[model samples]
Target chain A: MTYTFHWEVPLQNLPLFLWGALATLEISGIAVLLGLLIATCGALARLSKHRLLRGAATVYVEVIRNTPFLVQLFYVYFGLVVVGINLEAFSVAILTLTINCGAYCTEIIRAGIQSIHRGQTEAGLSLGMTQWQVFRYVILMPTLRVVWPPLASQFIATMLGSSVVSQISAEELTYAGMFLESRTFRTFEIFFAIAILYFVMARLFSFLFSLTGQKVFREAWGQL
Target chain B: MRRHGRSWGWIAVLGIVLALAWTASASAAESTLDQVLKRGKLLVGIGLGAPPFGMYDADKKPTGYDVDLAKLIAEELKVEIEWVDTTSVNRIPYLLTNKVDLVIATFGNTPERAKQVAFTKPYSSWNLVLLGWKKDRNIKSYKDLKGKTVAVTRGTTQDIAITKLAPEAKIVRYEDDPVAMLAFEQKKADVMPTAEVLALKKVKENKDMEIKGLVSRSWAAIGVRRGDPDWLQWLNTFMDWHGGQGKFAELFEKWNGVQMPVALPRW
Candidate 1:
């Protein structure tokens, strides 16, 4: 069987696609950052002095982690308007991904937090460090070193997961591919290009994350 | 005294048992009749968000024309109907991976698609309609869309037709029709090419958009994995029976005002 094939950049679509890929990167990046903040808070809550805070964080983690991301995305995009709270699809994409990634980030970070020896914390206390100082320079900083690799991996997963936002028509990489394939009727070719783009984006993210890790943890990189 | 040989004998027996089980499972998978009977439910993969086809009603019940057709198929097989909602991208995967027993989604049969799957006889027709601003007479047809941006959902007949007709018209593809609708509402695109029913429905809701012309004829059929002649014959008989009994006309009147065109062969 002969296949009528025309595979090219479809010049007119390039700028829009470039703009879309940048937006995807922005959404995923901001989400991972905000998600880190949420994870820190959530992980702290899991270790909080207050029972209610711990319960609340546990429930939030369980619910967000268990449900389908697509369902959560729709709930976020449509549920807002249903409650007289409206935001554009881009904002919803960021917000939904932050919540989605934060749940797992909380668990990963919690493990790091728990791994900090009672002896190191005691040493900080003996050195006349304030509770907040001990939590920061001693506990949090060291936990970060322990958790940074897994965190970078989650950030990668978040980038891939953000592709779900295209369902609400949030014009990311996958969304752009959908548009392109539909136009060209080159589903195989267009989707093939998109798969490569995703693979490249994933690799690029890992490379950058490694560079950032080197900058953030110079001593750790030296040991490596 | 012979412990090593005894262990080896047991391992050889385990291997033979596993091989027999694997063959049994392979043969069992193809007996779809037994599957349907055993399950007592026919699981169909469909997109429940699309209107006039597979869609959810206000009550959250799956109740579009395709939903009814899926129900009919289940009833014919003497099984209860279970609907699984999937997106356009996941539909083919759902069928190929055996996630669902069948699919009644509004699958547009294309030469490429025919390679991966078999299609039952066409049960419904879905043609493309050009929707423009209600008052725009200047952009009536493909000839007029030159240098204009037209928005359409990805993986649809409208997308193919627009590109085929007006290569000069810059096509902006959206993942869903609603996004294209928003683009049309915002005047980002000169027109939105979509299935006729959707165009008419969107035009009605907006009351400010108008459908210009029917662009191309298409047959939307229930899709199954390729090399299923047994399944295909069964589905064809079912479709032909229902199509002749005027179920489609009833479905059309039921699903708003998109009538089944008389020119299209029903059975």
Candidate 2:
């Protein structure tokens, strides 16, 4: 109750916090790119003519989406070590984030692909386009436009969820906050600053996604 | 609509901050001891994560050295005991925020920590050591810890000590003792720095680990909010009185299955 706010503690440790923020962005950025790749493959697999590919994709998505992310992280980081599969905390963090984000993004992407009318695919084929070209030009482009908002939200969620990686000492923004809080015992001040940093990061991600959407879609942006 | 929602979010945050300030100011007038006496209940924080010192028993009830000590303190105050489970990192914040009147959570007394929370005279004592697999004789001293992954509970005495002493050791800090110990057990880390008693317990359960190096002999004490001289003094006197009666030693033996290693000094 008689506590004094040490605003200087966080201010003095700005460099460390910045380094941690960079780590957060680095991990999340890598995860987002890898996750999107996995989601694309997974979406294609789920819609594939091969039953085996569809079944495997379904299992992967269901297994990841059903279980808690923390448990999955622990399994990769801690549980795997018991069987001689030791990995660094940062590597485990990125690995888990990629898989977790991949699972959710797969569902979103699959829904987007499914939303394309069968007539559009038939129309592309009738126009003398190859299968890959039609899939890319007709299905993929419109799918991106349709699912961009949800994918952006999922990407932001993954970035926010990266804070839990600090539990394994991954040295991200939340880890930096914890390190400062441990030293200064300024819990509220440290976490409050961290929350603001996360907010800024999320906003930045949203802005980047919109710019990307507009650039990629071009004239199709508003028309879609 | 977006601007309207944004303004409402700011207003909500302001409201919460003002509420916190109001409660902090209101509680500032009375010392923790006065509050406990007036409320007829002693709110004590204990870490259930650390075994022997603080843990659950066969019945899943909280029963450990720290818990027993807290019970004794509450009895001395003639008040009902209410336990607030805390972890290594949150112990000090719990005291600072008035969530608990005192924390007896295997909190090692350190000069750095003393700045945040007042510590009574030591009620218990233990040595911290770098524990690793018996097969890894390469880790014999602090210098040997170079490039090795050392797991520790975040914000604990051993975490700070190892970070300072063996700066080159890759420290992977978990949120609590159990998680860090689990990481060590799983071999996620090459070594773990923790209480000697905890290390010995682990070594007994699995024949692989042994003490690699000693970090420091630490004294555990009750933590109270800083600036509460009245509460701090009362706790010091309570520890001295009960400690002189060998009650703490008896509880230590009962919970830890060993005699007290170091005689707690009375100032």
The candidate that wins on lDDT is: 2
- Residues B5-108 of candidate 2: C-alpha lDDT, one tens digit per residue: 89759966985786578457536787788889999999989999888888888998888889989988888999998889999899887887777888999988
lDDT of 1 by residue, B17-50 (tens): 7545533432333645557778898889988867
Runs of candidate 1 with Cα error greater than 4 angstroms are A1-158, A168-172, A176-206, A212-224, B1-34, B135-137, B146-149, B168-190, B254-258
Error of 2 at A74 (Å): 1.1
lDDT of 2 by residue, A51-142 (tens): 99999999999999999888898788887876788888899999999999999999999999999999999998998999998878889889
Give a tens-digit lDDT track for model 1, residues A1-224: 12223446444466756666788899998999899999999999998989999999999999999999999997887666656776656788899999999998999999999998889889989999999988887788779888988988998999999988887667688777766654344554555556556666877898898887778777643532
Return the clash pairs for model 2, or none. Answer: none
TM values, all candidates: 0.62, 0.93
Q: Candidate 2: lDDT of A42?
A: 98
Q: What are the C-alpha RMSDs, in order, of all predicted structures?
A: 9.1, 2.7
> What CAPRI grade goes to candidate 2?
medium
